[model samples]
Target: MGCSKKKIKYELSKEFQFEAAHRLIKNYSGKCINYHGHMWRVIITLHGHELDEKDMLIDFNELKPLKKWIDKYLDHTTIIWENDPMLTFFKKNNQKYFITKKSPTSEHIGEIILDKAIELFDNQRIKVKYIEVKESNTSSVKVYSNKY
Candidate 1:
């Protein structure tokens, strides 16, 4: 008899892009402290051991919510650390902004996106494996789920 191996894992990924501006609030002394913008690129991966009833890990349409959320909140907006001193200025000026608990670095942004993906796709059959946030063509950060 011949030994056979069975497929046990599957993964699906989707890429999205948005435009946003941010400035590092602290722990940096570079030009990043000043406001800047990037055409952000995000790639999210889903992992599972088995396919669903439709023989698919997940329908691509199921991921549309994530893209829509990003476009609505992160695109064409300034992402600022919650405690940044400029918060008052933005509030007073009525500027479009998104507040983050941590500095708006690529690493933190990746973590935030990953968290949102988990919230939107939480299920026993599949989970968010990782999220990669590319601040620029040359710089990017990848955040992995602790459950993985």
Candidate 2:
């Protein structure tokens, strides 16, 4: 007789890209202190043990709204830490900007995206697993959800 175990896990992922600018405000940094922009790439993963009536983890179309939200708010916008002094300048000039409570580093950005995904999709059957944010081709950060 052979022992066998049941399969009980599934995962799905989605990728999105946006162009944005940010600066490290309070931390000791180098050239990044100056305003700069990058083509940001984000990947979100979702995990679940149960499938829906359609026999799928979740329809990829369900994630389109998340991409739409990012394109509307973060694309081509300067992301600024709420406490940065330059915020006043951007506000005065009426420039497009997004404010974040924490410094807008790649790691925190991943966390922010993860939080958004959880808010949009998390439920009793499915949950967000992690988010990977790539600020450059060779540099990236993966932030995991604390809920799981």
Candidate 3:
């Protein structure tokens, strides 16, 4: 029994969605401004010691609640990097709405979601080992667990 618990290792992936905007600061710019959107994809990895008799760490259905909550704020919304020039322009034009203090980069977004995940789980047993964010099919970044 003791060996079983120690030998078990599993990883599960969950997908989440959020819509936002941002720009990459460039020395010479062509066209990253003009405002754009991305279909952000997040994969949350869970790691643990043992699995249930069903051979699973946790049920997939258990994630529905979190997904519902995330969808409410992330779906169809644009996120602007606070330092982006466009933000200043918008402010000068008296255009203001929902905004975040962090940059809109994939790494930044992953950190935000990871923090929320840690808060929601709040358990040392089943830990979130990594969070990977995909800005597009070709671009992605991963944030690893500090438990390293």
Candidate 4:
């Protein structure tokens, strides 16, 4: 006999935005080498095979941790390289900054967010599918996991 309970494949997403400053080092040279700030936007998507008792794949409020993570790491902060000279100026002024192991480009940031999502929600049936980081209205990068 077929199962009486209804089955649903669910997908949910949340959006977040924060302001941050960064300069790319140990890479290409361009305007990005100059300190700049962007009202960065991120979209996090989660997919699940089963819903919780509340019939929800994930509550919007429960996703707050992701936002908190971004705010703590990237918001209003300067992103720099491991031993870039800019680190001295940023520190002297006591600026909030993240010294990324790799370049802090939007593409890399997308991967960072994706990793954070996997770490943040692995216990839940809701699995992170992708993370999109937008530096501007016209430019963005997406990182996703197909295995989920």
lDDT of 2 by residue, 1-148 (tens): 5333235788899899999999996765788999999999999899998889998989999999889989988999999999999999999999999999999999888878888889999999899999999999999999999977
Give stretches of model 2 more than 4 Å off: 1-6
Task: Estimate every model's Cα lDDT from 0 to 1.
Answer: 0.92, 0.91, 0.70, 0.85
lDDT of 4 by residue, 7-110 (tens): 65778989999998887766679888888899999999998878788988889999999999999888888878777888898899988888877888888788
Model 1 ranges with Cα > 4 A deviation: 1-6
Cα deviation at 117, candidate 1, in Å, is: 0.5
- Per-prediction TM-score, please? 0.93, 0.92, 0.76, 0.89
- Residue lDDT tens for model 1, 1-148: 5333245788899999999999995788899999999999999999987778898999989999999999988999999999899999999999999999999999988988999999999699899999999988898888999988
In candidate 3, what residue range of length 10 has the lowest lDDT sum? 24-33
Candidate 1: the clashing residue pairs are none
RMSD from true fold, candidate 2: 2.3
Clashes of 3: 2
Model 4 global lDDT (CA atoms, 0 to 1)? 0.85
Residues 1-148, candidate 3, lDDT per residue (tens digit)? Answer: 3556667677788887776566645342646645667888888887787676787777878667656655765666556666666667667776533455765567777777777776665365678788898989999999987862
